[model samples]
Target chain A: MKIDKSLLTGSTTMLILKLLEQSDMYGYQMIEELEKRSQNVFTLKAGTLYPILHTLEQEGRIESYTKEIPSKRPRKYYMITKNGRKLLDEKKAEWQFYATAVNQVLGGEGYVGV
Target chain B: MSECNLLVKEFLNITCEEIKAKRVHKQIVNELSDHIEEQTQYYIKQGFDELTATKKALEQMGNPTIVGKELNKAHQPKTEWSIIVLTFTLVIIGGFIQYFVSRANSYNSHAFFRFLIYAPIGLIAFFCAYFFDYTIIKIYSKLLYSALFISTIIGFVFINRINGTYLYVYYSAILFIPIFAGIVYSLREKGYFGIILCGILYGGVAILCLFSVRTIAFLLLSISCLAILTFAINKGYFKCNKRIGLSIIYTPIFLILILSVYYILSAGHRRERFATMFNPENDPMGAGYLSLLIRELVGNSQPFGLSQLKGSLANMKAELILPAYNTDFILTFVFARFGYIFGVIIIALFIVFLARIFTSVLKQKNKFGVLISFSACLAITIQFALYTLSNLGIIATFSVTLPFISYGGLGFITNMLLIGIVLSVYRNSNIIMESL
Candidate 1:
């Protein structure tokens, strides 16, 4: 499925922060992991991912450090900051509220009552 | 596979071409290259042919220009806004002062409008310098140094000597400091050859200033060079004892030679300036007249100042009193009209502005940025101090524009340009810190 950029735009940083909450990951690893977890519902271009990563790093919500993997290459690994974790929790709550509103408007009140 | 490698380089090159930070470029290139290599290997191990693996890896990385633009957005050099906003404020206030002072005179509205034009032009000059890529100095250090050198020598023919002071042309000499710093930094690996070449270029300018009558330029240039060398030493550029010792020996000796020449050239009114600085009585009617009156007026003007009196600012101007009040003696207009509080506020802002400059310099990881920023900061600080002291009748020898505050032409532009370079350095400096 082709995911519109707008669909991912608002929550991309949140997704990144949540993924990073599990373990520190480099660019290629995060891209692959997101593809696997989402079951290919979202195919993020590498171009789109970097600016979001950079902006997150600049905002102090994430920090990157280069580590050399043996027989491979030096890769920049990013980890979520304490602030990023707090932000992720808030974003999660907001997403839940947003999802509920949309579901109700779309006649899915059956699940809500149950 | 070789073709694939070329493809990787070309893609990364296009992706990062817009990004100017040396460290960021290398970092991104390495990251992208490694990812491509891994992807290529993965495809090959999956039974794809080498050509197919390479092609697939390149395709998956995405479009170069789009990626480059995205990366550029992140890496866009941040202009130091506090300085920009503060400088703009000061320029506006300076325009106000000029307008009010000019309007104070009954018939003359000329200076008021002239200042209106100069303010915007000065700001544009600043932005131009700020927006210009500062790395050009590093990339073409030798070329920049050579161009500034030729200009300084050529500067002599166009000296704008007004009221017994050579103020023009030599202002270009200030450009020498940063360009030379860029040289030393770029050629730092070349060891003694670089240091000697740097010294020779500096010595040439210092020597020119030594013989010329532009004492302000001579003083500003020498002091700025001292600041750059000190910063380089502190930043570990001259880590070896030999370089440090050589600079120590060469710098003071060079300064002494300049000082001796200045002393020798300090004949006529120049020598009289030093002789009458403390005791205005010695040459009270001669060179000491203006300084003596300045001291008396400032002393009598209390907390608020002479402008508190009816039409005193206009009165001072219309009566054709206080020679050159708009030019060399500009601070008198500020203090006499606005009062001591305003004068001190102006001084405080200068200090704050300088602090902003130094703080930015401290953040620069690269030695070239640090050195160039330091040179500019030192030049402005020294000029500000000397100009303030001279305005207060402490030292009559130093006559310079009070940076963005005072009114002048080329001198003001040069100072603004220097500030712009500092801004450029600051704008480009943030991305190099690496964690162990």
Candidate 2:
């Protein structure tokens, strides 16, 4: 099922931080990985991803570095900072709590019977 | 292949055109073009032709204008308004102080008019530095350093001295501090060799200071240069082991410190100055005279009102009036005339000015900006501290100007220019990329 575009907006930062938390990534790698991991439900545009990445970088949540890859152009990679990891944890808890609350409000398993 | 390259270049140009920060356009374009090329490779692997795949990648990256606009928003050139505002406030305060101090001493009245002229000239110099592209320093680091070094040596020998001090000569040499920062930036990739090169350059300044007998300028320049070098080393800009880098930088300074201490102890006049530094009563009418006078003046000063000392600075024969009241001892004059609170207000303003400069310095991402701004901050702050400490009799009295507040001269203009460079670094903080 296609996720609503608006539904993904607020979580994009959390997702990007979460992705960087696992390993440092360049822009294109992060986008492709996000799409594959989300089963193609979260195909982020390069336009959208870079702006968010740059903003996180400015906030010191993430930092960018240029790494030379063998036989290829130097790539600018973004790594999650300590602040970014702490923020990701907080975001994860908030997401869990939010999802649980929304499920409960919609009656969840109780609504399954209904 | 060529067709595909043209297509990618056009997309990059359109996208870069949208971003207003022209400095970061290359970096952002490099990054975006990499993304497009990667996407095109992926599509080609999935069976699309090079041109077709390039078109597909560009389409998926979304609209060029929107991407550029967003990138532009993220990379706008930053201006530090707080610094600009504080500098103006300090300059005006300095103007008022100079006016009043001149009014009190007719012999020094020309200083007020000079202040009128130098203050605007200094402000023009400040803005000129603020608007200048500091990258020019990076590009011309060695050339600037060599030219300034040679000229300073020439100035030392040829320039006429006023009252036994090389006023403009040493003042011009102070410009070496920031230019050395550029030199350090240019030498970053050379590892330990870079540190040694920097040490050699700094040794030149130290030797110049020693030969010219400008102890205070030497002390100020050395400490400021050491701070800049240490900061760069600690930031790992030199790409060498931090411990070794620090040791390489400090060993010479440590040796110099010991040697200078030994030299001061051995030199008859310097030994007398040193001994009197601790107990001014020993030489009440000679080397210790100024220290004792400062103590007497400050000791009797009231917090809210001027001191009761009655002597005309214009006459130069009074027991109470300090020498160079308009230049080096302006703070003491302010305390004597305007009260301690007013003096504290000036010091507090400097503290804020320094604090603001440092805060801006910390926000810099570009290493070149960091070096230039940090060195400027240290240079200015050191002069301000040394002058204030000297006025309060905590340190030996020397010929150091109180940055903006001192009667306007070459030192004041240099300080203004340094502040301008710092502001320029802050102004380009966001737009410039960190060097790899």
Highest TM-score among the candidates is held by which one? 2
For every candidate in turn, the CA RMSD to the true structure comes to 7.2, 2.8
User: Who wins the lDDT comparison?
Assistant: 2
Q: What is the interface RMSD of candidate 1, in Å?
A: 1.9
Q: Can you give the lDDT of residue B131 in candidate 1?
A: 76
DockQ values, each candidate: 0.42, 0.67
lDDT for B105 in candidate 1 is 70
Ten-residue region with minimum lDDT total, candidate 2 chain B: B311-320
TM-score of chain B of each: 0.80, 0.93
Model 1: docking quality category? acceptable
Clash pairs, model 1 backbone? none
State, as a TM-score between 0 and 1, how close model 2 is to the true structure: 0.93
Candidate lDDT scores, in order, read 0.73, 0.84
Error of 2 at B139 (Å): 1.6
Q: How do the residues B169-221 of candidate 1 rate in per-residue lDDT, one tens digit apiece?
A: 35666677677678767756555565666667777777776656676777777
